[model samples]
Target: MAGGVLGVGIGIVAAAAAAAAGVGAERLVRARQTAIDLGVEDDFVDIPDHEAAVISDAVPLHVEIDDPSPGSPTRQPTVVLSHGYTQHHGVWHYQRKALRDAGFRVVLWDHRGHGQSEIGDPASYTIEQLGRDLHEVIGQIVPKGPLILIGHSMGGMAIMALAEQFPEVVSERVVGAGFICTSSGALSTVDFGLGKQIGAAVHRLGPGTVSRLSTRQKLVDTALRAGRDVEDFLVHRYSFGSDVPMAVVRYTADMIFQTPMSVISAFMPTLLAHERTDGLAAFDGIETLVMHGQQDRIVPRKHADDMVARMPHSEYIVVEASGHMLPLEHPEIVNTEVVALAERSCRAVDSGKRRARGVPRNVTDLRAGGRSRRTTKRAAAK
Candidate 1:
């Protein structure tokens, strides 16, 4: 009788798995159909003169540049966007379009081991290395410019690491920054929506287990393929808040699914060990925005609050009905904040110039002068 019961239980489990996979397949089909109906092909026109910034660790970071509008000012501040773990520069599609339309030059790049970039030494997957990669990308691409830096999730952590290691760059070039859905430290303590005991055990055992598992790439791939539907469901659950469109959810799931498991495993240890609350001090004088979702399960709202407490001057916002993927889930709010910060930074720069020249700080006069200069430059370019 016990043997019969066990067999029945196994059968039930198989049936549930089959049902989930069927649902997931349907969602995927609908998402692709929607994309086709929308004629989204032109949205991905290849960026002209795409460059690669090769880091010291032999990782080639794929870089793309979107120059400001033809009539925009020559000295317009450049906005550099960094994506999070298991994501590439393509994830910044909406933010990029908004920034570009608002007359800001934009820079986007894939982190080493993710996206189209070549995966270099797995041992070099620490946040510090990622910071160095950022530095190199800046030095090689936007060598000299007033800048606004934006990062999400692990990308936010990368910016903090950059501020920690290269404070001079932050002070000298960066005028503004945005940290969205990210934490400075204590990630291990967060529940991550996984069971408390299970989360703890994963945190403790994840690194070593991943290292061993990575050696068997075929086995890992096969296991992942078998569990694709379950993985998609978990990603959708943890990554978004209430009422996200199914197409958007599927799009995000596709990005996550495309990332290699080895890359994910290699970065687990660095993410768990990340601690850089002190780095918040580096952006004290710079205009900064710290945003998070109220219902964020991965990083939590407290992390955003903690960052605000440290950098009191930084603007803090909590999206009411968003989750870990605030950039995609709440693009409009994020884009507005970023554009405002960019304008503020530009005004601050103008204010500093006036102060240095010992001229009276007249906001009206500065605005007129900037407009006149831009007009003159635009005519000359034509």
Candidate 2:
């Protein structure tokens, strides 16, 4: 009788603890959502009748958009943008604005485990699965036309995985590819501080366990305290080129913090073991550009150099004063290069020509390549 009473008491305590933890986590998530100031979601002009689809039954993977123009022969080439780990589609804000302004149809979506998207089983958040999502997105969007894939970090690796997994898709639909501040292989071999180690350990533990561990309020609270300082340092070092608006910086930090711990853990393994040099084959006859920051401490500059060496037909540009977030840090430079690539391709397209240009022109070319040697001599003399 005494033992039975003690057992009952323990059960009651456990139940109460579980309920309290649940309430706390719920409150945290809600607070996080409210604190996040991602500016206006309206940056995307919605396309009428656009709908999101649940890709997998086991996972509530979703794809949403404001595809203003659809089924109109896709007049402009489509660029599908993917964000890095612990980040949402908003990371591409600058690139999206620039691309849309340049008359390109941009498609940006959150990965299955991140952002406003529903988080399903932790197992569903692997890099392979992310690549699969890209494949499906491509199938739905550019069924019969060209696509330009732009990815940063994990997003970039996901693109390479897509190329490897769906060779046919690349051969058929993809026209140009951009890898910004990303690695082409074995991220664990690189030195990225806590990112690589924490990522590898999380991947080994499995997503479900990591998710559960992340729910521990004590751990979450402690990490949150330190994570903020780390977040600020990273944002300053990587995200901004120079001085960014304080509001923007704060908003970006909120998005980064609000990202659930499990989501980060699940995708960590994918980044570490990521090797997609083989994916370069898909860019055989396609235009490819690899950009990296020479000062990048995250993805490391050598990874980009290796990619340039591997992808024979690709152009490699090393931005001198940029970090891992080259797309944000050097938006003008990135924008200019992307625009030129698109223009050159459009000219070939309008002329109904399909000759492949193995080498891409650089900033110097844009400034002087078109001019005659005599004009160059005259300018130099002047």
Which window of 10 residues has the lowest lDDT sum in candidate 2? 1-10
In order of appearance, the predictions have TM-scores of: 0.78, 0.71
Residue range 190-219, candidate 1, lDDT tens digits: 755445754554455555565565576688
C-alpha lDDT score of every prediction, in listed order: 0.67, 0.58
Report lDDT (Cα) of residue 65, candidate 2: 49
Name model 1 segments beyond 4 Å from true: 1-49, 70-75, 223-228, 353-382
* Model 2 per-residue lDDT tens digits across residues 1-382: 0000010111122223334446443443343342243323323333323446546435554554434333323335677888877666776766665666666777777787677667867777677888888887777655656777888877887888887788887777677788887877865554333254443432343334544545664675576576554334345444443343345556555655566666655555555577777667677766777777666655667787677767766666666555666665556778876655655555545665534544532222122332312111111100
TM-score of 2: 0.71
List clashing residue pairs in candidate 2.
Answer: none
At residue 318, candidate 2 shows an lDDT of 62
